[model samples]
Structure formats: structure tokens, C-alpha cells
Target chain A: MPRRVALEGSHAVSEAVRMADVDVIAAYPITPQTHIVERLAEMVANGELDAEFICVESEHSAMSAVVGAAACGARVFTCTAGQGLELMHEVLFVPSAMRLPVVAVIANRALSAPLNVWGDHSDVMAIRDCGWIQMFAENAQQAFDLTLCAYKVAERPDVLLPAMVHIDGFHVSHVVEPVLLPEEETVREFLPPSEYPFPLDPDRPVSMGCYGPPYIYTEVKKAQEVAIENSYEKVLETFKEFKDVFGREYRPVETYRVEDADMLLLMMGSYAETAMLAIDALRERGDNVGLVRLRLWRPFPAEELRNVLRGVKAVCVFERAISFGMGGPLCAEVRAALYHLPEGERPKVVSFVGGLGGRDVSVEEFEAMLRRAKERVSSDELEGFEFVGLRE
Target chain B: MRGELSWKELEVGAIVTEPGNAAEYRTGDWRSERPVRKQELCIMCGNCYIYCPEGCIVLKEGRYETDLYYCKGCGICANECPKGAIEMVEEGK
Candidate 1:
């Protein structure tokens, strides 16, 4: 039986990890991310969860330890935010190259020298090419749901890439919300125990992650690219299986009231739900605008994104992080996905950045963004990103 | 150098099933310098045999000789030799 419980997004992730029966939890504590691994630590110390909670000195060692554990065919997990994610950057590439499904949750935050510990997409965007499956959660419920999906999707034999569930720091990570925590038996039925097809064993020894010289590096990378791209289908299959068992359906690109809307606001992370708040109020006033949220960030979900935005006249890509000189990290990618649409048929993609460093972008701001975005589309100003709620 | 494998032939994560690599690959071509044992100044100390990571140094014809087939010319043997019994000469010479 599923029980409704109030939990912070961090504890939701830990609960899912606990039920997943992860073999190792190796992570150093960092703000926002701390609540997750701390709860996990308590679980292990109290023997509520039987897993090795390695006390590592730094995020680098934390990532390194999980890689080794995963390589040895253990279901491994770790969590980090902001600077901690950057600290683990180099080691982040290892699990994917070695095809180890080390599950992780990122309480996404801003990078320093301003030293903000608050939530944003900057932390996650920095690791875009790290070759890991990325998923964003809108709230505590999705944080719990996506973490479970991540483990199942990542541990699939053909798709053994590490996965990161991005839950907005402070917004989702610290805020307590009602979550439908599923029974252990249901999760067990959903995700089977993961086994690396070629487990490192003494009897039948195998050397993994060997050196790839220049001659083979390109080919090896090509093979890796093909493998990850192919995993998109497997991800969908996992989502279907999860839905069959849990009765909650998830898609790479999730849509809401898009059928008749001429304009749509596509966003990611927790703010998408806030955008929905604005969408509801606007819909009541006869505004033909909808919402499109990207649940899956990597393997890009290019096709699904296209399907959702097919006939919409314009799309306001609301992102929490900017890509500096160009525009929003997600805005650029959304444009590229829609680039192949026949010239006049493509939606005018107006980019906007807001809610940086845990700053709030209010319902009125989203409503204002829509008016400005529609104006920009009409004025043929579908170029560069406009910062919303900027102080004059 | 030409690769020994096609991309289609790569195992998952390129895991090497046959673990002992010293014998599987002839890493001789990797050497830019070769160690030539000075048979006359030999101490029979066996330091080269102990230090060679490839384990290609052994007593052959009553001399501690470096096997050319497997030596990577890492100069470990020359560096470890106390009596200057092994001289590392340029490969072309």
C-alpha cells in the first residue's frame, strides 16, 4: 500500500534510494545536498538501510569511491550541489565511460565567487556533456519518482550510464511536501537487482576502463555515443514499466493543455510548476498558452520536444540559468531541436532567463513574460535572451 | 599504428577479459630506447630482472638479458642497475 507522507525533496530521494536497496552510499555533505546524504547516513547508521556509507574527505573522493563500488557490480549512489559537483567534475566522466550505473541526485545550485548555495540550473548545465542521463524534478513527488526511474533506467544492461536527478536546491530540496511513498514490494517489482554483465571477479578476472589510444579513441567514442543515444528507447520502456507498476506516467517531454494553445512555455526543474500556476490563471482569461516541461534533460529528448511544440506559433523557453554570451542553456538546445522544422512552420523561440541563485520569478512575472514574449515574436525579435524581473 | 579491433568488436566498456596483458601484446614497438646489457661489466645482481615491469629480463646464455619482444624501454632496468650493467642506447643506434 502506498502511504502519503510529508517529506523534503532530499528525504524523498533518500527514501527512494533506501527502497532501491543501494549497496553503497558514498557522498560528502554539501548544502542542500547535505540533507539527502545525511538522511542516508542516519538510515545506514540506524541499520534501517543495510549499505556501506563511506565517509569520504571530499566530493572527488566521494565520486571516486562510488565509481569503484559500481565497477565491482554494486548499486551505488551519491549526491552533491554547486561547488561539490564541480569538485567531482573530472571523476564524473569515469562512470559513463566505464558504463557504470552509479545513481545520484543533484540539489542543483549556483556556482561561486558570489558563493550562493541556492538553486539554479547552472550546476547541472555545467555537466551537460558528462555523458550521464539527466532528469529534472518539479517537486518532492517527482524527486522521489524520478530517482526510482533513474536507477531502473541507468541499470538496464544496454544503458549502463550513470544518472542524475536534478532537484532544485532549497526550492524542492528543503521544502516539505506531501509525497506518495510506495511500498518496498512495488519498487522491488519495478526495479530488479542490477548486475554488471561483466562483474569484476577474482575467479574470472577482467580489466575494465583500459587505455584507449588515439587510433581507437574516436571509434570508442562513436560507439559510446551510439550506445547512449540508443538508450532513449530503453528509457521510455522503463517509464512504461514504472507506470504499469506505480500508476504514474512520465515522459521525456511532458505537456499540459497544449492541444489548442498557440503559445507554450517550456521550462525545466521546479519552476515549471510555478509556470503552471501562471498558465492556469492565463487560461481562465482566454489566453491560448500552455506549458511544456522537460523531465529528461539528456539524450536531449529532441524528438519528443518537437512533437510537443509542433504547431505552437511561439515558445517561451523559460530557463533558470543562462549560457553567458549566447543565452539560456536550455533555450539554445530547444532552438536546435526545432531548427529542422520547415521555415515558416517553426515556432518563434523567444528565450528568457529568470530565477537565478534561488530568486523568485513570481506568477505575475511569468504572466508579464508571456506578454513580452508574444510581443517579441510579433516584433520579430526572436533573438538573444531577455532577463525577466531585472531591476531597472 | 593500425588498430587491432573494429568498432563493432568492442566489448561493453572495452573490458579486457583476458587479464594478463604482458603476453597478449608485444609492446616492444613502444620503445624509443633499448637496454643493452654490458655482459663484461655484469654484476649478476638481478636488479634489472626485479625492476622490469614487463618481467622481460631473465638469465639467457649466462647473462641477464632484456628481451626485445616485450621491453617498453622504460629504462627502469638501467635506472635500477647499481653496477651500470645495463646501458640504454637510442633505438636507431
Candidate 2:
């Protein structure tokens, strides 16, 4: 029995985490990410979730607490955003390296120097090499569904990696959308209790996260890389099974009207929903356009992305974060993925970064970017990334 | 050293699966100098015993002595001795 209910993206994520029967949640609140942990805290207080809700001091302790909890073989979770994420940066590597299945959500926010709290990908892009399995959710439903899938994939014995579900701050986290909640028994069958092989216990007397001096350090790191790379199989399998049980489909790269399009708009996070509207508006106006949304961000589906973009003419990557000296981070990775394709088959990846600090890139604006991408890939020489709406 | 272990053979999570595995590392080979104790000046006050970074000093015969088997020859024992009973001699001699 599934019930359709309207839920904000933050509550949607927290609801799925509750259904997963987590053992611990160590979270410190930050803007946008606050709603999610607040909901979880409420659930724990109401006895709706039978889990330890630890109110930690800072985002660093929030992450470190989950690492310790996961090391003790507990199903753990945490949430953070923006500057809070950077605070937790150093401890972020512990879960993945220690092979702990700590599932957390990032309500994606812009990093600060001038200090702005808004929806963006800057927080996520900074931690691209942290070795966590990251997935970007386009809307509330996807956020809920992916959070559930994260637990299954991360706890897989062969995978044994931490997971991050990225939902755009304010845009998705605050917006209310309809999500289908499956029965508790259904979730129980889908995600079994985590069987973490190396639980820290006094009786076992095993040392974890031990110092890896010289020779073994390289060996250990190589093993970790291989493990995360190889997790694609389990992640895909779990997604398939989730469709069978929950009846909602999930994929590494979700496409909208991509067939025989003259150009494609590639993006991630909640913006894809708005981009879809623009694509439709353009499609109706006789411009052949499509949208490619990155659902899986880590152990990056490079080959899958290349396969999708191979026959396409060109792809305009719309991103919310900048790679500073370079262009959009996702655009850089997309180019690298398409680089191996035999010259003519590769699509010209046009990078466009905007909607930063939560500024809205309206439907009309997206249509313009597609036209710009087509013009550049069609007649004009290729240019680097463009920040679409910056004032002179 | 388990450095010979292949990537596949390394323990999951790189956890040291064995208890008391630190004792197996013969760090004494890293020594550039060794601590020597003079019997006459030694009061067995346990200054070196507490100050030795490796905790390798032991009271063998009512006098604190440095055990060379596990000591890294850090010279902390000689540096900390109030009576100047210990000297750091070069390893070759």
C-alpha cells in the first residue's frame, strides 16, 4: 500500500530516512539543510523514528559522530549545507575510507566569502574527490526515493561506502511536492539491517582506521578507488529493484525528450525541473531540444554519459557552481567523458554557469542558452563557459 | 612488514585485524643512536623510565636501563635524566 502525500523536499528526505530504520542521526543545523534534520529530530521526539538523534556542536562533529556510530556498526545519517559542509570537509573522508555506510543528505547551498545562503552546487563540487557515492535529486519525489536507494546501495557488503543525496537548498528543500510513501514492511524488505563486517566492539578487539604507513597506504587507497568505481553495479541493481518495489524509476542519467534533438541541456539538481519547462517551451516553438539530468554524481557514470551524448550534436551544460579558474565543474567532467569518443561523434559540450546564490534562471533564460549553444556549436567558434545573468 | 600484502589481500577498511600488532614492528632498527646508562650515577628515581618516548627503560637491577630491542633511540631518556646518568652513544659503536 502506497500513499501519495504532499511533502517539502526536506521532509521527504527525512521521511525516507525514517523508513530506512536508521540507528543514529548526528546532525547540526545550517540554513536550507536545517529543515531536514529538524524534521528528523521531530520524528525521533514523537517516537515515529526509533533512532538516536544526537544534537552535535558543529558540522564537523556532526559528521564525526556519524563516522563513530557507523564504525560501531550502526546505520547512521547526518545533514549539512554551504559553509557547514566545508567545516565538515576533513572528517568527510573518514566514512568512505573506513568503509562505513553513513547515509547523509546535502541541501546544496552556495559557499561563502561575501556570504550568501542560497541554492547552488558549490558545496558539492568542493567535495567531488571525497569518495562518497553522491546522487542529485531533481524534486521532492526523487529526493525521497534516492534517499531510500542510498541506504540500500551504501550498505551493500561489496560496496560499503558512505552516500550523499544532494537536494538543492530552498528550491527543492522548501518546495512542496507529491511523494509516494511505501508501506513500512515494503521498505524493511528492500533495505535489510546493515551487516557492516568490521564493527568496533571490545570483545572483537579489532583496530579500525589504523595508520597506514608508506607501502600499505597506496595499496589501501587503490582498493578504496576500486571499491567506489565498482559500486556502480550494486547501485544500478538497487535502483532496478526499487522500481520493482516502489514503482518509481531511477537512472544514472535521466533524459527528457532527448531523442533526435538538435541540442541538449545537461544539468543536475532541482534546476532540471525548471529546465524541463524551458525545453518544452522551446520544443513547442519548433527548436529540437532535450534535457539530460545527472542523477548519480560520484563514481561518475562517465561511460553512460558518453553513450547518451555520442549521437547528439551538442550539449549545453547549465550548472550552479563555478570551478573558479575553469568553468562549471560538471561541464569539465562531461567534456572529459566525451573526450574519448571518436572526434566527429563527440558532442560539443557548451558550459554555462548561472543561478548562483539562489538566483532563478527562468524558463525563457534556459531557452536562450539552448539557442546560444546551438549557435556556438553550429556556426561560431567554441567558447569557454558563460555566466548567463551576471550584471555588467 | 605486511607491506608485502597485495591490494586484494589487505584487510577490509585497512583495519589491523590482529591484537597487539604494534609489538611486531621492530622500530629499534630505526635507531641512529642508543642510550647508555651509568650505574654509579643512576638513582633508580625512574626519570628516564617516565620520559623515554618508547617507554623502553626498565629497572633491571635497582637501576633504570634502556632496552634496545624496541627503543627508537630518540635520546629523550638522556635528555631528561636529572643526574646525567644516561648518554646517547652513536649506533655503530
Model 1 agreement with the true structure over A47-146: per-residue lDDT tens digits:
9999999999999999999999998899999999999999999999988888889999999999997989988889898899999999999999999999
Q: Per-prediction TM-score, please?
A: 0.89, 0.90
- Clash count, predicted structure 2: 0
Which CAPRI quality tier does the interface of model 1 achieve? medium
User: Clashing residue pairs in candidate 2, if any?
Assistant: none
Candidate 2, superposed: residue stretches over 4 Å from native: B28-52, B55-93
Q: Specify the highest-TM-score model's number.
A: 2
Give Cα-based local distance difference scores for all models: 0.90, 0.90
Task: Note the DockQ of each predicted structure.
Answer: 0.54, 0.65
